[model samples]
Target: MKVLIVEDDQFHSTFVQEALVEALPEVTEIVHAANGAIGEDEARRGEIDAIVMDLQMDQRNGIEAARSIWAERPQSRILFWSNYADDAYLRGIAHIVPEDSAYGYVLKTASRARLKLALRAVLVEGQIMVDREIHRLQRRGTSLRTRLDDSEFNVLIDLALGLQDKLIAERRGMSLRTVQNRLISLYEKLGVISEFDDEVTLNKRVRALNRALVTRTINIETLETAHRDLETWLAGR
Candidate 1:
């Protein structure tokens, strides 16, 4: 069986290559791509049987690459090897994966045995393998009570960046009152406020942001992406 490894870091790519050789005796050829853009091109060749994909890269992200790959080849098998189990990454993966695709999400910190197990499950047995922590975050993200709609999530991102209600209103093209209402909804969804709290003293916005960070709902990468987006928005305005 032929395999492809798409990772930006040389050390990690080498690690995966060595591990693949040691673990999966059936692997005959292993191809490597330095970034997601090249990985996408290589994957479209229709020669690779399975892919080991990294989440973040310079040219493109793994989700974007995988989405394009799966669009062309719906049956493509991929194993996401990432350092983050952040909600944004999980949500991106959940959004793009085909209904019947076989995939795996394993952290870089996973034990060698666990990584081998994931490889066999995805590459050989055609099964889904997700890290336990990631599975929990996925459940929470999909839960109706905890799930933030797009508008609420946007507001949360702005708030996390220390944007005021008026600024968020301007950026989102919403009335100030509407932006405030979204904040209220966001706080409720994040469990930072309650209806019975008639005499609230704590800063709801700060509390909600803190809760989100602690829960891995919004992480450093999420904020970094938001910052870039905000910069683009500001430039256009």
Candidate 2:
């Protein structure tokens, strides 16, 4: 079997390769790509049987690369090895994966035995593997009461960046009132506001931003992805 490793960090790439060697003897050909862009290019060669991919990279993100790879090869088997189980990353993966295709999502901190198990499950047995922690987050993600919708998430991001409602409305193409309404909903979802009367004394928006950051709901990677998405939208418009 031909296996490809796509990771920016050399140590992690080597770690994956070593694990693959130790676990899957059928993996006779092993190739490495330092970043998602290079990984996508290698994938276009149409020779890789499976891929072990990292979530974040310096050039392009794993989700974008995986989306591109799966777009061209719907049956492609991939195991996502990431350090973070952030909802944004999980949502990104959910949005792109091909229907009914077997894949895996495991944390980099997983034990070596577990990593080997994931490799076998994805490559040999063709099964879906999701870390228990990630599974918990995914379950919470399904509950509308616990998670923010995409629109609310956008407002959260804008708020986190210190953008006022007016500027957020201009950027997101919503009316000022709509922006404020979204902010109210976001504050509620984030538990940033306790009571209506507390809005004056408590900086609800700032508190909401801090909550989002602490909960891993928003981060630098999320911001970067949003910026790229906005650029794409602008170019298309």
Which candidate number would show the highest lDDT if scored against the true structure?
Answer: 1
lDDT score of model 2? 0.84
**Candidate 1 regions with alpha-carbon error over 4 angstroms:** 136-183, 191-215, 219-237
Q: Rate the local accuracy (lDDT) of all candidates.
A: 0.85, 0.84
Per-residue lDDT for 217 in model 2? 81
Summing lDDT over every window of 10 consecutive residues in candidate 1, give the lowest-scoring window.
133-142
Per-residue lDDT tens digits for candidate 2, residues 1-237, read 999999999999989999999999999899999999999999999599999999888878888889889999988899998988888776677767999877899999999999999999997888988878777756775466868998888888777766788778878899999999998888887777774563368678878877887878876667666666666765875
Off by over 4 Å in 2: 136-145, 149-151, 154-182, 195-207
All candidates: CA RMSD (Å)? 5.3, 3.8
| Cα deviation of 219, candidate 1, in Å | 5.0
Put down candidate 1 lDDT per residue, 1-237, tens digits, no spaces.
989999999999999998899889999999999998999989888499999999888877788788889999888899998987677776667767999899999999888888888888998899988888666757866577878887888899999998999999999899999998998887888888873377768888889999889877777656665777788898998
Residue 71 shift from truth in candidate 2, angstroms: 2.6
- Native-vs-model 1 lDDT? 0.85
